[model samples]
Target: MIRFVPADVGTIGQKRKQVSRACNGCRAKKKRCRHVEASPKDLDSQIQAAQLAKGDDRIDAINDDYATSPTADSSTIPASTRPSLQVSPSENTRNPVCQSTMAAPPQDTLAPRFVDGLNPEGVFLAVHSPQDTRGAFSHDRVGIWLADKLNSKEKQNDRTLTRSWPQSSLLAGRHSLLPPHESIRNLTSIYFKRFHPILPIINESAFRSLGPTDPAYILLQQGICLVASMIPSSKGHLFLGDSEVPLQHREFGKRVVSAMRISTEAGVITDKIVLIQALVLMWMFSDGPDARDVSSLLCARVVQHIQSLGFHVYRKSPDQASHYESTMLCCVWAIDRLNATFHGRPVLMHERDFGIDLAVYIDSQMPCTRLFLHVISWLDKVIDMYRPNAELRSSDLEIPFDSFEDLLVQSQSLRIPTPLLGQFIILISLPRAVFSLSRIWLIFSPKATIETLYHAVSILSCRPRSFNTKILSSASRSRRELSAERVTSLVLDKQVCQLTYFPFVPYAVSLSLSVAYSEMRHTKVPMLRARARDKLQINCGLLERLGEIFYLAGLMSDMGKSTLDEYDRIYLTAVEDYQQNYSGSCAALDSIRATERVEIIDNSNAVPSTSREFESNNGVNGHSLLTQESDPSFYVDLPDLDVFGLFDPNFNLDGIDAYLEGNLNLTYPTNF
Candidate 1:
């Protein structure tokens, strides 16, 4: 030191030792060691800073350099070689401070530190910041260097965790079950083109924006695929190509189950539009063994959900809703109302609850949609009016009849595009048939008494009578009065029949034929009577043809046969009674004539006196001498002529109220 030796003038080994002994912070800055002479306070602060910079290479080097530093106070050396130091409390202690001036030790010398105050128990501890406990990487420049290695370890741990806890249920594992994008697109196209016109529950633009991975979209797609696969090949050709594949029943069922589970688990039923769309599609496409019953149960579930969600009471304000949403609400309500009617169940909502006006909807350019909504609304009105306690009068029927005729006229006037022709026919004709049936129901309700029956018969028989003016004035004017002749003619008209081909036609035709036959049996006019019989035969032939077209009609055909057989039994009884009365009268007249001839021959001389005696022997009036030619009660005494058995003791025509109050069994079709 007195000679002032250069600090860099050490041997090769000595230089390497000096470099190794340097604190990492000084080495990193390429400066001489300064922390070696740092006071305890400075050292503690440096230690904390190092811990905060957990993965810094400088922290390890600082720990190593402190362990090998020769002197606790390097201030004696030249200021150029050693940085300045601050004094700490440890300098005042009497204990000898530990010092290290030796050359760097071998690799074995590197170990965790056990410093006083930092590790009082003499156990080695690695100092690190709280952030370091989470990971050994950082976003700083130095951290970028460590991220690659740390990220690799993290990925491995994630893989291990996934393997340890695997998803077990289909819903929990639906991500892998999503169909290919191409398949989804194809099915969606088929659905939009074929089913949407009929249902129109989904908004195409909004649905497309949700993308394929959305859970609700997945459910809708699965339903669509199921529906598409079930469509007959002939119908499929209208939407999809021959090369397009179809899903198997098992696959379709699994998808449906998975979609339902996902929706339930995710609690998406709260989303009214999605839930309604899915439910409506499911209701429409449901088919298999017992499909109608299953679908009906499903419809009930939908109604319950709708009520729970307050959809039945939801009103659309023009400023608050999009056109699509309003249209969808209308469509869903229509579907629900129509399905309830078809199943003979109570409607979940009433027409008055709806804020959307049918009159407004009817004026919209979408004729098919307007017609569909109009028909369902009319049906709802029919249900309300037909209830047991409803204050229904003949005037109440006028609105429905007027609305029905208006809808039919509007439907006929519209030049429907060719693509919608099939749906247009179904939508238009189904309501037309139901309207015809409702008219029949109104005329023959359980309230109908003997006089009403006679009046109805007279109208159905198309006989001109004074009663016609009284009855026809109250009932609304239709395209034609609801009569047996009109119904039969409608069923037999080649064009109209072809347009309205469905199971309902056969049902209406059968009921009308029964009514005609009942009225015919009591008709005194031979010409009208024969005409009724011919019309009955013609309608029966039409029913046979309808049965061939619709399998459900076969069941209705059996019901028609039972009705006709009952009519025949009553007619034969009445005819036999009339013939017996005629024979007895003829025999009485012959006896009277024989007695008269005998009296005339025996009293030939007193012929004038005998004639006077015969005239006087008769009652006060000559009319009393003849047998009464007419029996007013002849037809009235015949069996209660319920040709359709609608008013039979086994059935209840008490109306919709009875039906809603758990007497639904009475509403089931006899053949069903």
Candidate 2:
């Protein structure tokens, strides 16, 4: 999760000095207090100032350290129920200055301000008192590193880029990114006509009225063209004059983004509402073609900029507010939450940030807008449970499933389209299926593993229908083979991995593929391995198909292929081990069973030791991660390494959190 440190913490400590009597500032206002008593009050004021600088919420913790003493004295107040400063041995060890005489403030009373409003626990900083450590815990391994790096670089680059490139030159360069007038105008019309009906974040009539000279129109046009580049025609050309535009989909997106950044930095475009509308559209470009770092940096700026302009706090005034603003805010909230999970970091927008309730939209809201909000609200619940960035987590299988039933009931009541509803049901069922798989390979209880193995297999074999096949029924031969609308119509009519606008589908599918690959490597359980392999293949195929639509999924699909090859190597090692376990008992019998056919057989004697042996032997680093303390150690063993630590239901069940997880493929394209 995200964290913050008080800028005045060092100064607060430096200014503190031993005093027998109240100082001038305290003496003038308050007659009866020592200088030490004033320290706690000083801490509050200083921390508030620090939080203000960082643009975080101000804390309102009660100050109960004033009338306090180290020893029982005759001057002590009457024994009352009021809480006061007290110290324990643990607090004393951390603070030597307060160990001897100064009473430490109790922890339960002090409130640490949070950067990510949703997560209750994470690597955080506390500035309540001197007794409190500057940070809640060490963030050496669990902290958000990318956001920090990007945040620093963003400050430097935005300022540098603005000075290095003049507004006139930047504006001149932006035109080069745009497609020919006719080509772009047609593409924009197609996008609104085909895609806008499904995700109505922008109003069609009001938007088209604005001309090309308007900055809003220009930004929206650029964003739509970037989205359109991924969609190719049947002949594989974007426009009739495709030779004139040599830029590929990903490269085209990069140039457009750079131009948009320059225009914003130049302070030339001052229309806040339309600018945010374009920013929301840019996020739809996804993470691969357009870098995720760009999305994260933009999300931070837009959320802050929107709040600073009072968009979040006041939307009740009809003259100042409109349905478009409300719809856009939901889109922003969804993007923030989606990226927060994908990156496993803090969210910029919070549930309480906006006054509008996205789950229940106005009656006049478009069907697509309403459906999108409903889908997002359901997704938001799933994300909250995962809390991907939270430093501490309970075991997956142990968490109660009862809560999700209510979400299911709520979904059943919504007026979602039938095909879309079926896809959503499949999406929600994944967590349950994943939990069952985690119980099988990761758990040591043979009886439970054997039982869950069958249950998980049945679930995995039921492949999801991700695309809406019903749309294809309307496509006619003449419409596709003869009409000029063939290009746009095919993109809409042809089956896709899922709805083009819904972005989180790729991450869910990719993560499932990773876990399924992990589960399929056991080899000891024939049925289990076979079942997991099927799911892995299905997920990999979906991700591959999605690659054509979104480069993020393409990146994931590439990762999946590398993992598949790696798993084959691990399978070979497992077969060799099984051969070692069983010798030729019969003269005619084969020493080792065929690796491909082994999982298909259910004979108990044919299996060897658990996949644990495979993981320990063939680990990427090929080393034991355990310490003398038997503390949960995190180390990657390539394909078999279980760094996520969620593989085992019993392991890390208590307060433990693995320091790190995942085998990331950081080799990205040069366009980023």
Provide C-alpha RMSD values for all models, in order: 24.2, 24.0
Error of 2 at 131 (Å): 44
How would you encode candidate 1's per-residue C-alpha lDDT over 1-672 as one tens digit per residue?
Answer: 375533432222243533225778888999878554544554454443334334435544654444333212222222332112233346323112211121222222222322343322211111222222122122321110112233345557867655434333334455445455566566566556555654467777777788655666666666666554432321322222223454453345445545654564355444666776677666654334354575576566666665666543456454454566556656756766545544555666565775555344444425556555555555555555434443345445334233334654654524545554433244455667685565331111111111122222223222112221323332422222354466566546543322222122343455455544544544556555556556655766666665443333444455445545555555555556666775667677768876987888887855666665776686422334233343332333334433323334443323321222111121332221
lDDT of 1 at 480: 22
Per-residue lDDT of model 2, residues 126-211, tens digit only: 22221332332334322211112233355578777765566446555566667777778767765664356445656677788988
Alpha-carbon TM-score of each model against the true structure: 0.41, 0.48
Q: Give the TM-score of candidate 1.
A: 0.41
Each candidate's clash count: 3, 3
Pairs that collide in candidate 1 are 69-100, 70-100, 70-101
lDDT of every predicted structure (CA atoms) = 0.45, 0.46
Model 1 worst lDDT run, 10 consecutive residues = 441-450
Which regions of candidate 2 fall more than 4 Å away from where they truly are?
1-172, 232-247, 286-290, 315-320, 356-364, 387-498, 521-524, 548-552, 570-585, 588-672
Best by lDDT: 2
